[model samples]
Target chain A: MNAALSWLESLLVLAGLLSPLMLPMLYFLLYRPKRRDGLASPIDSLDARAARPSFFQRWHCGLKVACLLATCFLFISPRGLAVCLADVAIALLATALSRPSWRRVLARLAAMSGFLTMLLLMLPFSGAVQAGEPTYSLAFLPDSLPLRLSGLGAATLIILKATAVALLMEPMLSTATLADTLHGFRQLGVPASLTQMLLLCHRYIFVFQHEAARMWRGMRLRGFVAGANAASLFAIGNFLGMLFVRSFERTQRVYEAMLCRGFTGEMPRAAAPPMTARDALKALFWLALAVSPLVTEMYFADFMRFLGE
Target chain B: MHISDGVLPISVSVAAYVAAGAGVAVSLRFLRPEDLPKIAVVTSAFFVASLISVPMGPTSVHLLLPGIVGILLGPAAFLSIAVGLILQCFLFQFGGITALGVNALMMGVPALVCAGLFRWLQNGDRRRAMCSGALVGGLGTALAACFLALFLATAGENFFAAAKLALVAHAPVVILEAVVTAAMTGFLFRVKPELLCLPPRSKWRGKGDCSL
Candidate 1:
């Protein structure tokens, strides 16, 4: 009776320890939110937000890309947890200022969760243990699978840094229309041809997506089901082949139409608004914000020495 | 597996950007004026096709199709892939902005090599062409997995296990891509032999049919 009670108590303790990790999975499986079709097109949301007179939206798109991207790169290799946390705080502030829908932010986080989960699962157990690093090995588990504290800290740092940058992407790119953003890239010395291709590709992505969806519906109506089998793969291949054939045909028609409209290999550039002093000041502000974490980590090293602790 | 930002060391990321820029410049050199819109439209199709998920035992994996893209686009494959990746980064955040260059090289370099391999190996015979497609398809994914592992391993010693796991995880995907690409190539060979004969530009003029 005593052994059984101890075993039950230990199981409960294990369950309590694991419950937090399982929360996300449980939320996804049980309380999955209804899909909002309105958020389906990222372009529509960008366009809607582009009309707003926000601080970021008012900034020159070219300068915005340059400054924000510089900041993001600065966030890449943070030396300490304090720096990582500071970057995350800055990112969250940027997200709040940008006013991107919470759903969109959450969606981006969800998209990266798989990779992050993999890192979290593997890193602690498999990371190399330095001579004096603390490690925990379960009684039943092999000694080879010791969980290192340093690995957990490394994983935490990576997750924080990555989340910061991911959150910052919205404020950087989505503040303006994608066209304006691509044009901004062009202004920053991106090849006109590449930008033009990106523009065209972006436009057609929605159309082709619709066509593919329609085709998928048709296939489903005919009792087609995807499975882990040779037949299913062949069906999918044929489906892809058909999509290619149709797109190829559509490409010819579209190009001919563009030729009729006198598209002489270049998209006509619209006159860009001149950069203002305000834009430069805003850029400087962002650059300073981007550099602060590094500044703190470097010059004030004693205060941020907790990483080693 | 697109590398998220902050995962790669900054130096590795910057170097990748430079190399990818060089690759895009070389690809652009081969591109003709009229081929621009055509490639753009085809890239959209490839982008959409990639969104389709195929079920594996307990999970599903989306098609990467770098080999198929290489087979279809030829010399222009790198540019097309970079464009698709940019859209993906902005729209879906499959990859982060800082890591875009590494991601491009990860997918695009394999595509260029596969294009070359497919061209060299394929003959007029449909069966031979299909087999070549299968070989290139598997090799494309295998090479991409290697690049991903290499990139991850560069981060630090701590990432080596994750890198190895990434390589192992792609094994199933490599097989799936091979079979799907082979089937697609066979279908294209039977239905539209011209597409397989030459790159997108020559096919526009309705020339270069393989006489199937």
Candidate 2:
């Protein structure tokens, strides 16, 4: 009964610390600005969303930043694997609830699985060989298991932590549009110029993607197929070089256009309203909640020790 | 080539950010105000470049093009790479938010190195420039693999095998990158040789024009 009570208490402490990190994400999901259809450009739609902000949308950026900060802190703390795993499970549940086009996450995971598999396979055999340590061998031959079971445990720990963070990123980022996130960064004092540069880069990526696709189709028309040979490589080289040349020319034209339009160095953004008292109070509450994990880790451990004594 | 988040300890992550920050600072110092748009455009190209894959067999592999960025952008390659990586993180979730600095370093440092090497060796010699391009591409991938291994090894003894595996898996990629970079360099040599030259740092501040 006592053990169950202690476990329940510890779980509660974790929940208290974790709730602040999670509530904002939930709030953003619930109160995210409704998208207005019939917008010609996605950028225009993003602007429309900003024009009619919800209560939670106003502070979503700060909330995400706070949650991520807390998550990072938790990751860094000397918590046990079980606790960390539990936190990761919570994050995974949140991500699933957010309902992103999850194929992206799956694809990324597919890419990462190779590395993770390598860790899983090799870590077991790489551990230091010690006398009287638990060892297993492949086949009947006496092959030394230099990999201690403890090493495998550590590898699992790192993998779980990494996977958890990666899974959590989708929901954390997906709920807010990229523009809003950048704006939030600006609110957090990231330079306006940098955000502007990022926005420009983001916009042009689609432009170049289309250009490259068109060029690729042109190549297909010319009967070019990728092959493992010098000639194919040369063809690819020409294609890339041509792409760069076109992109360079476009840059010059873009520069000229910007200058013609009175391209001052400043990036134009809609002014955000100043933070209110309620915003501060809510932020403080979340901030306190975020810190609770560290506090609990420090004090709860001692409390358990005291009880034992 | 992107290091996922939570793989790095906070201290290592912080250190990488510091190092990458220093690189960005140097890049910004050399960047011209007028060239900001060019940088943005090239940043987009770098981001999009990853999507263009070449079929090798049943599967396809994309170009990293750190060498190409280096050959083209010179000192500013780091900033371009940083922008590309940030976009990839936000849009594609290619790398994690916290690992941004480390991932940038893994790609950007190699780009800067290749840029310097290509400049030192190209010297208006077409044959030599192509060779240098191949060297830069191959060596850049190799070095990135090394960095990845070193970072993984920091986790402890258990990761040693994993590190080795990472490097080994990249061997074919290194050769393929060398071939592609060489091909691109050769094409540039015949077409637009001037693109091989680094842009003037800042028109008002730098000594010469952006030409070979």
The residue-by-residue lDDT of candidate 2 on A28-88, one tens digit each, is: 4554533221111111111222333333344556555556555754664455676667667
TM-score of 2: 0.81
As a TM-score, model 1 comes out at 0.90
Scanning candidate 1 chain A in windows of ten residues, the lowest lDDT window is A35-44
Name the top lDDT candidate.
1
DockQ of each: 0.59, 0.46
Error of 1 at A305 (Å): 9.8
Worst 10 residues of 2 chain B by lDDT: B203-212
The fraction of correct interface contacts reproduced by each prediction comes to 0.74, 0.56
Evaluate residue B96 in candidate 1 and report its C-alpha lDDT on the 0 to 100 scale: 87
List, residue by residue over A110-180, the lDDT tens digit for candidate 1: 66767877777677767667886777664444667766778778777777888898898788777888778
Docking class for model 1 is medium
TM-score of chain A of each: 0.84, 0.70
Q: lDDT tens string, model 2, B129-203?
A: 789989998988888888888888786676777788889987877887888888888887777666777334322
| Top model number, TM-score | 1
lDDT of 2: 0.68
